[model samples]
Structure formats: structure tokens, C-alpha cells
Target: MLVSALCAMLGVAPVWVSCLLFAVAGYALLWLFSPLTTIMIATLTAIAVLSFVKPHAGAGSAVIAFVALTANNMQNNLTASNIVGMIIICLCPLSLGFGLNLLLARRQAAAALKQRLDREHTARHLHDTISNDLAYMILRIDQASHRDPPFDQNQYQRQLADLRAIAATALDHTHQAIRQLEHTDGPSTHIVQSDGETDKQVEQQRKRLDDIIQSQRQRLKSLGFQGDDILGTFDQPLTDDVLDLLEGMLNELYANIAKHADPNVWYAVTVSFDQRHVIVSASDALKDAGIQLGLGSGLERYRAIIESVSGTFAVTDDSGIWSAEITFPLCRRL
Candidate 1:
């Protein structure tokens, strides 16, 4: 359009001829200069030449036409428009995108808040019903054992049967609450699910851990790493939370190895469980010194996870080898 306008103003060859020439010259100039440079050079050259020629519409029309063309051609150029015009033209889509992102963030926050409230309600339910029942049973037992009376054996047996009935009812109610909580969407849902079918849950946990370990080992093998893994049998029960985190921890560890380990060297992953704690460790030779390594956010995140559960995380870099160890407790404290 600019080419046609220029040709019309100058009474040059045909419009098609001018456009073809401009396109060819533009395609060549772009090979040598950036788009902005080419635009500036072309505009200045045209204006300089037009200054020598007779003025067309007082020369301002040609200058305005050039400015319009330049502005339309460059999306991010400061010369696109006046402030208000720029805001209306360019910032509308950006503002819409930001508004959408804010809405999504708010929705996520609302969901998280709901989950937290649900957990609190479940905790309160347990304390209100289960705790009171247990306390009452304990008091009755104490009174039965230490009361100054002609102890009635039949009455005592009746009280014991009542206490047992109370305990059973409380246990049933506790299981129902746990089931409801397990259905809620959150990180801790799996932990709640752990309470049902102990043998099945334990088997699933073991399979998950073994799968993660074997996956990492296979990945290392594919990377030409000769690695060893000692997936020792657990001596004690691992808390549901600890078992859940192990999956993430192992993935992060293997990811770190994939990113930084020397493919030609040996890596090792060892799992050892004692009565009190479970130990997991991985070690690998570092890649060449020339390869840059980032500050391991993965390790830092897992460190926080371990420490939150009263577990410990340790890392050591020595003699071109990197190693990390995690020691987590077997029991989950109330």
C-alpha cells in the first residue's frame, strides 16, 4: 500500500512494478540489517530524497505516511501510538491475560482453603468424640480398680462391657471420618487411605518405592552409569507421609543425577532400615568441571520436606563425587 501510494504521488511506473521492486530490495536489505535498521534506513533515505524534490501536499503527507507504515510494521516500537492509544491497542490483551491468570490463582487458593478447613474439622471430630470416650473409659477403669466399696464383680463386668461397646463405636466413627477425609483432594489423602487394609496399603507402598528406585536405576543404566542399589527390607513400619515423600525424593535425586552425573562413572543408591529410622542414600560422580551445575532447588525442597517430618537430609560433595542421605523416622507422632 505504501509502495502504491508513493508511486501514485510520484507518477512512477505501475503500482505492481514499485511493489515488486520494494519487496526485492526489502528481502535483500533484511539479510544484511535488522528490521528496525532497515526501516530507519529506508525512511531516512526516502525523506532525504523527497526533501530535494518538489513537496507533495507540503511534504507532511509523505512523512505521515512513512510514520504510519513504520508504526504499523513494528509491533513493539515506541512510535506505535500516543500513550492512551497504545494502552487501548496493545495493553488490552495483556490485561485480559493477567486477569485470567489472577482468576485461576484465586480458584486454586479457594480449593486449598477448603481442604485445610476440612482437615481441621476432621481433627476436631476425633478429639470431641474419640478422646472423650477414651477419657471416660479410663476414669471408669480407675474408679473400678480403686474405689472404697464392697466391690460388685457383676457390676464391674457390666461396666467393662459398656466400655468395650463405647470403644467399638468410637473406632467405627473414626474410620468413617478417615474415609471421608481420604476422598478429599489433597497431598494427605493418600495418608488417610493408608489406614484402610494395612497389608494391601503396605504392599502398594513397597511397590511404589521399588518402582521409583528401579526407574531411576534403569535411567542411570541407559545413561551408561554402572550403579548399585541396596533396597533393604524395612524393619519397622514407615509412616504414610514418609512413604509418600519417598517417591518425590527419589525422582528429584535421579533428576539431579541425570542432569549432573558423569555418564562414564558409577552411581549408587542404598536403602537401609533400622528399628527407629529408614535411611536412603544416593551417590554419583560429578560431570566434567566445565559443565555448569545449578543451585539444586530439588534438594532444597526435599530438605524442607524431610525436616518437616523430623527427618534429616544431608548432602556431601567430595573428590568429584556428590552424595545425599536422608534419615526419616519410622513412627508418625500424633
Candidate 2:
């Protein structure tokens, strides 16, 4: 109706007025129509034809009409030289709006990919680190319960408390990963830090690993298997990323041993580390277990995590003993 009024004010003929109305209506409907470009092009062509054919109208008048219609609709007063100039100016908003929408969509897609990667990374970390530690801890607790001198309740309770703390910390780390996903742009947070305050966090993680290993040894003793030499040897400090990955890998190995290894079988875990690489060798009896050395179902996921940090992992099952060797370059601090 406003377009019709504007055409009337311009003293256009009835035919020209009808053409102008058709063009305006067509443009408006384009928003809800398929092939928007087709609709827009048709509308612009109609307006041009009407402007040329109208008795008193000329190129200048047509340009003025086009500019007026667009300005009125967009609530902007813009002037252009000719009809062609007016059309060009009118396309500016549409171009900008479309470009902006595309940019935002791309950003959203990138963020979603990042979140998925993070989730997988967390899963592998937990599987490799926490799972192994817990298995070892459970084994120790089992052994402690069957001690020859009779299990000391106070010592057992202390160990149990320590286990609970480790479990709690793992849960906390998982929660932090979840929160990071939920609020990707909210703030920067760290799972563990190297600052003086983070010393306590580091000690807690180390203690948890120690407790789990101790528990496994105790459990082995109760089952009549000697586990005297199953100790972790750390010759070099581990970077945060490497530590996280190793912890996850060890957890998976320990869980596998607890679930499959026989009570009478003896096992030993030796961790050798240097500035360039780390190797974890597990020597255990597995002749009757029928277990093969290869990438287990869980290892496929673990492999992805290791690869993300430019690392490599390999497993060798020689006779009844299995050794998982993971080698990766040290990540330099930026």
C-alpha cells in the first residue's frame, strides 16, 4: 500500500503504477519464496521496464523511485545517480547479511568439532590412567584383606580413604571437561597446573597412582603371586600433556590384567622414560588366557588421543607376556 501511495505521488500512469506495485509485492514475497534470486531479478526487471515505458518517466525518475522505495523500507535515506546505481546500492545490505550468516555458521561448525575431539581425549585419558590405577588399587586391597599377620583395619582404612580421594579427583577432572564443553568461550581453566598452588594437585595425582599400585601388589600377594618388582621408574619429569596420556594408557593395561590374569600368575610393570620417549613393559604369565597382543577395542579410541599430540603406540604380546609401548616427542612449552 505504501508503494502504491509512493507511485501515485510520483504522478505515474495507471499501468506504470500497477507495474510498480507488482515489483514491490514480488520483492516482499521473495522472502518466503523459493529461488529468491529469480524473484528479485524479475522484480527489478519489471520496475525498469515500467520506468522506461511510463509517458512522463525517464531514467532519472526511475532511479528516484527505486531509491525512495528501498529507503522507505529500510528506514534509510540514500541517494543514487541512476537506476543502475540505485539497484547496486540496494544490494549492499543483502550481500552483507548473507555473508555474516555464513561466517557465523562456520564458527558454530568448528566449535562442535572441537567439543567432540575434547570428549574423546578425555575418555582415552580416563581409560588409560584411572582404570589402571584403580585395578592396581583393588588388587592391593584384596591382598591386604588376606595378610598373614591379619589385616590392620586402621591401615586399610587409610588406604581406602586415599583411594576415595583419587576417585574424587578423577571425577572432578571429568566434570571440568564437561563444563569446558558447556561453556566453550566462558573462561580458560586448567585441569592441573604447575604453579606453587598446583603442587598439591600434583601430589594428589602422584599419591593416587602410588596407592593403586600398592593395592595391586597386596592383591597379588594374597593370590600367591609374587609382585615385588612391579614398580614405576620415573627418570625424567613428564610434561602435562604426556602425563595425561600415559596415565590413561596405564589405566587400560591394569584393567585388562585384573579382568583376565589368573591368581597364580606373576606380573611385573617397568616404566622407562627419557627426554625423547617412554616405554611401559608389563611382564606377566598368560599362556592359558588365550589373549592376543593387538589393539583392543579400547585402544582404537586411545590411539586417536595419542595421535592428536603427535604420539605413537604399539603393543607386543610375546608368548604369555604383554608389553604396550607408547612413544611421543616431548611437547615444548610455549
Candidate 3:
């Protein structure tokens, strides 16, 4: 509206002056208003200038001056030539704004996707590292409860109590991880600590696997499963890396059994070690519902950890029984 008013005032001047004002007004409108509006104003200004100017100038000179004058007219004119010029000016801003908006939208979307990926990565890391270690701790505590020579009974009891507390804490952490996966917000920055203190954490964690099998044995017996003792030997003491991975695997297996296995069925867990590798296996009788075949997220993550350290995993569910087998190299010996 301001540009239009200015153009109106300029139109009252001589043809040359009016042409200059028209050009300025047209350019201003192109910058401020829609491209279409700028073109319309320029077109109108061109026609007005041509109509007001006399033709007494020579044809060639008239043509040249007309062209020059029209070029100077920034205001939209009613004439076709002026209209075209206004349209060209208006298109500049329209195209530029549209392209800029598109680029910005894409960048925002990419940033959002990256944030989601990072959050998921953090959740998986927490589950694989922290949750698994806690599970292993529970297993070891349970095993310690059933030792042959038997360390102090009170100490064993205390350990069992600690195991329960750890289990509860791990469950809470699992819930948090699930929430994080479902969230749309940015990634968490909090750091997680694993249970083992030294480089031997992994070996220590592996020994705890025997404890888990022992505890499961008791649970199975209570449910009327007359099973043999779990058999396994460790070639090396537990290290932090092995402990972290095994803990995750054990937790996944326990969860599956708790959620899907029949309470009345018998099950056995066994581990065997050689100079080169260690194998851990769990076998359980299936209920009428049968064992679900697909690997759960916990197990899948464990599998990934195992593979990352050059290990192998296999799961089998035949008839009504399920078995999981994991084999990994013994990198650090006891």
C-alpha cells in the first residue's frame, strides 16, 4: 500500500520523473509484496509513462528512450510490457522463500531422526551392559548360596537378599529403557555403571552363570522337575567384557522362561568349557502353548554383543522344549 501511494505521487511529475518513480515503486513492491503484485504495478507504471510522453522524438530515439525509461520504472504498469517486468521481479522472492522453507524443513526432519537413533542406541547399550550385569550378579549370589563347603550361611543369605534387590533394580531399569525406546524426545546423557570392578569382571560374570543355573535348578525342583545338576567349567576367570555379555544373555533367557515357560515343566541349564571356547546352554520343557520361536530384544542384543567379540549363538525350539546355545572364544584365561 505504501509503494502504491508513493507511485501515485510520482505519477504527477513529468514523464521522465514519473518513469523514474515508477521504476523505484515497482522494485520496492517486488521486494515487499507478492511477485504477482510487483509485476502488476510495474506494468501499470510502464503504460502510464508511455502514454504521458510525446512521440515528437525520432522513431529510433523514441524507441530507445521508451525502452530506457520503461527499464527505470520499478512501479507496476497497466501495459503488457510493464506487467511482464513486475511478474519477473515478484517471482524472485516467491521462489527464494519457497526453496528456503523446503531446505529448512528437510534439515529439521534429519535432526529429529538422528536424535531418535541416538536415544535408541543409548537404550540398547544400557540394556546390554547394565541390565545384563545385574542379572549375572543375581545368578552368582544364588550360586554362592548353594556352595559345597558352604561359606557362612548368614553371608549367603545376605547375598541372596542383595540379589533380590538387584533384580528389582534391573527390572526398573528395563522399564526405563522401554520408555526411552517409545519416546520421541532427545537422547539421554546419563552414564551407566556396570557391576564388576576390575578387568576380571567378565570372568567373574561368567562364573555367576553357574550360580544362575543352580538357582534355576532349585526353582525347577520346587515346581516338581527332577533335573540333574548343571555341568560347566570355566577355562578362565571372569572378565568385565565376558561378564557383561553373559549377564545380558542370562537375563534374556530368564525373562523368556518366566514369561513363556510352563510353571510345571522341568528345565536344565548347563555350561561347558574347553581350551578354545565356552558353551552355555539352557533347555526347558514346553507347555501346551509351546516356546515362542523368535529371539526377543534382550536375546538379540546379547547375540550382537557376543558377535562383536567373535562369538556364536543358536536357539532351538523343538516339540515342546527350548534350548539356547552360545559359544565364544576364551580370550583371557584364569
Candidate 4:
């Protein structure tokens, strides 16, 4: 825009190089900043530059020259023909600017479309992680029976603190993950979906899963569950989907405890790996004091998550003790 305006104004000025400088600066700003904002500002700036360029011809003169130039076919007036030529020469750069702006508008739309798609994809992955953890907390609360609510004022207070910490962690992770999603590989940078997630992306997700386990452990400990809780450490590499599924299952298990398990019962978590498959299991000493201790819908939901990746899910009530196990072959590469 600045270039076009300068070219329009300069016409044949002694300091014509100034127009080139303005054009360069305008293009630089447009490329470095948002195309939309730059185009708007640059368009106005171009008009301003044109106004100050001291052209012998303008909108008014161009109209007159157009009429005379049209008559030049029949009339023998050199001056009118020259005026028409000048008008065409003066309008060339402005026309170029108009076309350039239009091209930029198309590019802007493409970029926005790219961003929307990437945002949705990232949100699904990130939001699922946080939402799954949060759902577990909610389920725990819903499942707690008031028959003989455990803890006194201090216990209730501690439970409140633990809930707050868990929620805070989820909120923080949601914000950070989504923010990274939007900016880390901006809209202009296209990702080939067919290529799947890169090594770095897979590694980052694995780390996130580890953090989820750590935070969940802290939450369980705060709720009076500490002995032998599994510290999830895998000796083998796994695909992103498997890692996510594993983390989600553990989160669901915790939620089940929050919902069904007796507060006074002992809880333990176990995670193991064999030659071909990894096993993640949990058990609880039941208070069975007439409570149902059933899996209900939670079990089905967890089963679906595990089985989606061809994994197996099972829950057993051996005497007064309750145990659940999930196992799947690891996909080492993403």
C-alpha cells in the first residue's frame, strides 16, 4: 500500500527513492505483523502518500483524460492522448496495490481455517486429559455415602484443600496446554496429518502422562490413600494413544475409588510389565459393611477406553477385597 501510494504521489519527483523506502517498510510490516492490520493501516497510509505526492493528475484529472482519450480515435489532439496516457500510468500502481490486498485477504482466510482446525484438534487431546481427571474427582464425591461420613472438621478441611489443589492443577494444565497448542506451531505452519505425531510430540505427551500420575498420587494421598500406590514408570516406549489410554484408565480407577470404596478400607495400586504386555491393576480392602461396591457405569466407560486399543479390562470381587486390572501390548513407536 505504501509503495503504491508513493509511486502514485511521486509521479516524477526529484526524491522518488523515498517511495521505494516506504514500500519496503510497508511490505516488511505486513510480513512481520498481522496481514489484516497491516493492510488496513497500509491502505490508509498509501492514500495519504498519494495526497501529498503533488501529482498533476488525480481522480478529477483522470476522469477528464479518460473522456478525451476515448475521443482520441476520431480526433487529432496529441494533448488529450498524452493526458490519457498519463492517467493510465498514474493508476497502474494503485491497481497493483488493490490486487495485492485482495491476494493477502485470501491468504488470511486460509490461515484462519488452518488455525481453527489445529485448535480443535489440540483442544480434544488436551481437554480430554484434564476433563478425565476432573471427572474422576466429581465421581468420587458423588459415590461417597453419608451413612457414616469419614473425618471430622479437620478431615473435611483437608479434603477440601486436596480437592482445591487437584482442581487448580487441572485448570493450570488446561491453560498451559491449550496455549501451547495455539502458539507453538502457529497457523501458518502446516502439519501433515498423515505423518502422525512426531517423536518430540510423543515424548512430550508421555511426560504429561507421568505428571498426571504424580498429581493423582498426591491427590489420593491427601484423601488418606498412601500405602503401595503405583508409581507409573514404564521401561518400554509406547505410542501416544496407548499412553493416553493408560493414563486415562488410571484416572478413572481413582474416580471409582472416590465413588465406591469405603474410606476406612486399605487401598493399593500395582503396575507391572511382562515380555509382550504391560499390566496396570489396583485393589482395595473393602469395608463391605452392607455397601454395594459395584462398578456401575464407571467400569463400562473404563472398559471402552482400554478396549479401544485392543486392551483387556476386568474387575473381580475376591471375598471382601475388590480388584481391577487393565492390560495391553505396547506400541513402541508413535
Over 240-324, each residue of candidate 4 has an lDDT whose tens digit, in order, gives: 4566556656666766665456667777776666766778888876656455466655457556655766778887887767888
**TM-scores of all models?**
0.41, 0.50, 0.40, 0.44
Q: State the lDDT at 181 in candidate 4.
A: 73
Please state the error at residue 119 of candidate 3 in Å.
Answer: 7.8
All candidates: CA RMSD in angstroms? 25.5, 13.3, 16.1, 13.3
Per-residue alpha-carbon lDDT of candidate 2 for residues 218-303, written as tens digits (9 for 90 to 100): 54554456643344444334566666655665556555666556557766666555666666666566646576746666666767
Shift of residue 191 alpha carbon in model 4, Å: 15
Compared with the true structure, model 4 gives a TM-score of 0.44
Of the pair 3 and 4, which is ahead by lDDT? Answer: 4
| Model 1 per-residue lDDT tens digits across residues 207-275 | 778886785576456445777877777633467556655655666666667667887888888887888
Cα RMSD (Å) between model 3 and the true structure? 16.1
Local accuracy by lDDT, each model: 0.64, 0.59, 0.60, 0.62
TM-score of candidate 3 on Cα atoms, chains taken together: 0.40
Deviation in angstroms for 68 in model 1? 76
Identify the runs in model 4 with alpha carbons over 4 angstroms from their true place: 1-164, 173-210, 286-289, 294-298, 332-334
Best by TM-score: 2
Where does candidate 3 stray beyond 4 Å? 1-207, 215-231, 289-292, 332-334
